[model samples]
Target: MLGGLHFWFEIRIFMHFIKKRRNKPLYKKFLPLRKNVQNRNKLLWFRKKKWQKFQRAFSRLKKKKLHDPKSYFLSTFKNFFSRKFKYNLQNKQRLSLFYGGFRKKYLKRVVKSTLKEFKSLNKHVTVLFIEKLETRLDTALYRTHFSYSFKNARQLISHKKVYVNNKVVQHNSYLLKKGDVITLDKDVFNFVILNILDSEMWPIPPKHFYVNYKTLQILVIEDIHYTNCLMYYPFWIDFNSFLKFYER
Candidate 1:
């Protein structure tokens, strides 16, 4: 009787596990279609978790001191594994299609247009790549420890908490240009410098405007972001020309 009761109890626990998992719609419905959608979902989830852990590890390292080589080595290994994991997870074609259709729509459009324009103007323009502009905004807010995550930055801006050149800017992803003074809600100004030291984290904004602080010059005041700004650069008049013009 005890053996029979034990078997019954095991069966009941198994059923409870099934019931709990069935509450999640994806797992419930995705049992049979193991070919395309299920695999794609798995890849997406793996990439997301990997990226989150990578970000957390990087954040912790940035805050702590690295005196010993052993701790540094482990942290470096974690970073490498995180990047490799992301690369593996990102290699799926179906997942790419899903992301391209919805979440990465704007990014794809921007890249396609930029590449097309580059090819048209200079047929020699071989290397074309797309990077998220939001990454810069995120660095300004989080990695630099200026504020926090992108979500917090957006919240701060929408509440009229950020300013540019003495005017309130509610837009979070405001593409910064040279000579554009970025202030904080009319309170204090943080000098936005170009050619920043940390090139990996804070990439220099796509060069449209040129600034020479010594000469006190500003060139190509194109307030617009992300279009043909970086594509067309006339060889005759270099970035120095802008400085000379401003100097006079």
Candidate 2:
């Protein structure tokens, strides 16, 4: 009877777990994330639960350090299975995608063209690649603080809410050029301005662009190289690994 009761209780707990996770956003569903808050700019903190998720994970880690036999064994098991030791290539690919929503093929093209462009200039490959990546319209929007996250900027562009040079352009991968102008619908643009006006975020307005807060306009004054793309690029990314990924 005790064994049957224990099995019944376990089934009830499993059902509760399923119900609890039903409404969680897609982001919180990812597990075992050890990234710092600053490194996860793509996370939109729409709810307090987003922050609490990290807190809970950290609390779990703290419990593992208490030296209990079961805790030590569990921690050892996790460390044995965790792939952080082999994540160098994964980190490089993530860096390329984190700032912008471009895919592997697009990233390959960016790397290829950036290498060709560097033939005439004396610059590091990764730095030049970062400069080129920043030329994306969505990256500029996120850097300018017009959007909350890189994913948010891509959503706005894909929804046809962003305008380039007074024309509606839905492609998030559209590479920006010098003399190009960016605008958005008046209501949404004003709302964003108000949201960001009093905020102080990292990697302040890039030096390569001009933003007219009053007129809701963005002008690209300079091209790659002159831009401060490194400010937002994650420092942990292995540029050498990224180069190898693209070279292949």
Candidate 3:
């Protein structure tokens, strides 16, 4: 009877083990289905949020009177013209500042002549013109080790202490052309050489220009190209828009 009881107990335990194993498949199948449902719901929620964001942006744009084609075009044109006018005014002010201390009429004449020259050169006023202005005798002196600053270079020129092609130039705006040779007076040369040795003011020369440190002279070997000028002084003025606004 004890053996029969033991056998019955073993059978009961075996049946329990089989019953648990059969339930495992059901748990596995239902658990994965539940997780898949959760993932699908999460994806839907994310898509709904993205759609809401897009809707808000669209509503804002519509409220700004941008939904109508004619209104959109008019608003765009107004903004463009306003910005262009403001830039042109700033350019005029810069030109006036460049000729500072000169008579207003003379400044206006210079601006007009410069604009006319730009119009005659290319359909767009290229950066080469700006480079020409920047590489003038006084400007070059300031850029090289000859002068402490551009103002100092201008003062030196005005005092007849600077020469180009072996002739003294009093005007600071005298643009240096290709193949021009620049030299300094003996006194100014000695003074600047001493300063250069004392200070760490040595800057690389411009690509088209070369400076002889030994002889204290500069030579413009080539003309300033548009590509090179753009690399140096980049301006935000759009050439096509500038031409259209000026009716050039």
Ranking by lDDT: 2, 3, 1
Compare candidates 1 and 2 on lDDT and give the better one: 2
Best by TM-score: 2
> lDDT per residue, candidate 1, 11-124, as tens digits?
999999999876443332322212222112232243455355433333333212221112212112257768544333332222232222224455445445545666565432
Clashing pairs in 2: none
Badly placed stretches (over 4 Å) of model 2 are: 1-33, 37-53, 56-85, 120-123, 226-229
Worst 10 residues of 1 by lDDT: 233-242
lDDT of candidate 1 vs native? 0.37
In order of appearance, the predictions have TM-scores of: 0.34, 0.65, 0.51
- Candidate 2, residues 115-217, lDDT tens digits: the string is 8888988987877877777778888888788887788888888888899988999877788988999999865876678656744555567778898878778
List the candidate 3 regions with Cα displacement exceeding 4 Å: 1-86, 89-111, 114-124, 194-203, 234-248
Model 3 lDDT, residue 224, Cα: 67
